[model samples]
Target: MALSVVGVVLCALVSVVSSHGYLSSPASRNSAWRFGFGTQTNYNDNELYCGGREVMHSQNQGRCGVCGDNWRLSEPRPHERGGVYGKGVITAQYRSGQVIPITIRISANHGGWFEFRLCNNNNPRARDSQQCLNKQLLTFADGSRGTRYNLSRSLRGDVTVHVQLPPRLSCTNCVLQWTWVVGNTWGICSDGRGKVGCGPQETFVNCADIQISPKRGFQKPTTTFNKNKNNFLYPRVSLVASVWFAGLVATIERDLEEDVLQTVVFLQRESIPDQDLFIRGGISESLRPPGCSSIVESDPCAIDMNTNLLGTIQHYEKYNAWRVGDTRLDWSGAQPGQDVYQGIPAEGTPLVWTTNNVLSPGYQELNT
Candidate 1:
């Protein structure tokens, strides 16, 4: 009898420790990450469950946790929104009508249905609750609603879903919450009148911080343009204007056709510091160079070091990519700035940006 009790306890421990899932692509709060926010890295991030088998709505009258946590339970699990993920870092930015992919990794197969929800937290820090996220049940482009991923049983593996963002919704302090509610657990109904599987069950949650704005790309470059006019080469986004110590400044002008974003880039090679750090900066919107009248169009995302102070904000300038000895911002297929150098050139020009905004193996982004 004693051995049987011990075996049961060990099995419960094993059940809790193994076979859970999390957002692997967008880098959930529990996921392993290096940049963005002060977070403690969890290499084994998938082990956390929302309520697990402990807190059932029928038995405990417990509420589900926000962001893969069960903080409101009788015996609450850790509040993931407060612990490792408190400093909600904006992992990604997208257009309101964009279709993005969410990938989930399940180490052990547990019969359950999963969901992805959103909360446009008014708080800049993205401190949203389960009540807030419940308002925005995200729907995949394929018409699968949140909590509608009813999995009867399945193999343990990675699952990727291509989800579409709502056409009208936009949020700076956005929380994309992923939850997995287990289905295998058997329990009495909330009223103690229903059959098995009619009560509370195991659940897991994970939240990813992101930003979404209405189509900010290149539809109206001269007018309303991509709000984040970041330099393609140097990848650190600076909130303050004067703190940007390196790279070119973008003064987006010239309204063109759909999906074709054309920007007049300026590189202030003079103000750049002699260090491993590189910073990308953006200037005020509208008009020509710093004068708003003396504009020069050399190539796309390239300037011939033609003039000083390219925009009205006379803080930064654009230079020729060949002059800097670095790769181009090839997002628009521009040939001038698209050259790639495997090493730091003999002239010691920092290859701050990458081929398509993705850094190479050696290049690292330094925060401002």
Candidate 2:
């Protein structure tokens, strides 16, 4: 018992001190230091694979937190999205269909494979579920859709790739996630019947809140995805610039708070991400989760507001969802372009209606 106690204590220290690899560029949610978050940050942002196999294989049954958090908890922790972290901070911004280079810093190289996925969830008040991110798997924009990272062979430190954001897709707060499943662990098969070099292994993830907007000279494409699975959205896109919100609400409540619910209706500009938050959703062919496209249900102008009462405090049961909408549209030190929802719902702001003849609902609000 004493030995086991010592071992457990040692493991906890290791969890905080050392991690294999992490997303160093574009500022992931776990790694970046936002003023709103104070000093509350995950010291071991890279070591997040269900607390290693001891917890992953034994306790959680291969489950993982959407943003590389420990799987033992029933829900995401405080540092996770929708978990009352830095007010759903937006770290970076990019234009849809632009190729941007992503850098991964490997501290301890464990031969493995990594993948990048995005969930265009605009609401800054909900957890970024794994089911939602699975729908849109990102690929290298250089025509390498089914990208197989060659990390398993030699141990390299930094790996950078240029990827293109989906065309014609925009979001106020999108979760840009990077997951790396380690390839070192050897284990028995699921049946426990046969041995394998790569049955189950440690996984790591890091996420960043990002905003994607329409390009200056871009027009909405009428064409659907290409037949070839490799190039799902568009043909090979050359390197242009780069990459990139929403998650949980607040734990505390204020006595009086002012808010606004707005919509957008413009696609022809240098760029217009401010009014695109509610442009995508159950347009409901698939039975995916709510806010898959955008929280507001449909866009250039989505409301992202729900049935919550306008001017009064309410119980958890009083809101459509405890997680969908937020109080503020901006963050503390928001960068110029990274600031999405710029002219968004505030106390004094009035609700924005869709432009005439834009083929939109009269309004798109019903979210938080």
Candidate 3:
């Protein structure tokens, strides 16, 4: 009997950890991260606003928490005009036409889809009221109504949704609703049958208080694509060549009097470009110097100087391949001297060289 009880308890614990998530971006009402204001996992019912068990109908009063609610440990405080949390201040302020980053934190991977809804209810408590539920389903700037956006058809961990707020939204204070509905209950079962296939749907809902103002000449962000029309060589090529040439010049200028080992060390440090144009371009074999096109073991200049530069270049290329989602590149082959110049050791393989038991600080500083 004790073993059976333990097994049931373990199964219950596993179910609790299976699927849980909450809105993290635009700062939800529970974003303050207090003890009671965490993820609301009791999403079996339609508690759309703040995911609270009891529905809040008044703008002055807050949501209620059931005493033995097993889903979450604490209940979020009321976030209305005269409520205790946030002091009635808007959680976030933005203008229409701005790309708002919506981040959702998922504790466990579950098959589901996300829905974003917007309503111009300046009053916090009244926003999620039953009367306002239908009114808040906004017609987005693109003329789409009722669940403006959907993401992740399958199970996923953490995800971010970038959405441009409708330019038509000119409300002073508004509530943005985020709803996550579990796609299907495959493992959950009871009475020798699937307890819930995908019937009513287990849904998690949260809201963010935002103030949207008139657009003040805000231009939508765009990426500028400059054609490499000049000599077919990219700015990255010149940058790499310059670093290599600089190191060579420095090595020669300091005279053969400088220790070869010390010069190599200094060159490695000094040759590292201060900018991150190399990795941003997605490092590949195509970026190799034009002069050092093929494996020219015979050409002394290509073999010695270019090979050394290639080593440095390959290091960054390997780092880029590792950072970006490029599974094709053989990261294991990114060892120094893998691409040798005659008998001499060429560039160090990517991410192999380290300082203080970590990759060079420069690689860590890249924005991407």
lDDT of 1 at 307: 12
Global lDDT of model 1: 0.52
Q: Which stretches of candidate 3 lie over 4 Å from their true place?
A: 1-13, 34-81, 123-133, 136-157, 184-197, 217-368
Evaluate model 1: give its TM-score. Answer: 0.53
Query: Candidate 2: where is the Cα deviation over 4 Å?
Result: 1-19, 34-39, 84-86, 152-155, 188-197, 217-350, 353-368
lDDT of 1 by residue, 87-117 (tens): 6566776777788888788876667777888
TM-score of each: 0.53, 0.56, 0.39
Tens digits of lDDT, candidate 2, 1-368 = 99999999998667434547777677777667632434347676666565776677678888777777677665666456766443566667777687878888787665677788888776555677788888888888767676556465455687887777787665667788888877656677667765433687777877877766545434322332222422211115412122211010110001001111223321111124442222111111222223333322232322232122333343222221222233222111111222123343222112222311112233223321
Which has the better lDDT: candidate 2, or candidate 3?
2
Per-model lDDT: 0.52, 0.52, 0.42
Q: Give the backbone clash total of model 1.
A: 14
Model 3: colliding residue pairs: 311-347, 336-349
Q: Order candidates by TM-score, high to low.
A: 2, 1, 3
lDDT of 3 at 312: 41
> What are the per-residue Cα lDDT tens digits for candidate 3 across 170-246?
44356676766565454344455555344334456666667665464332112222235322224435545666555
Count: clashes, candidate 2: 19
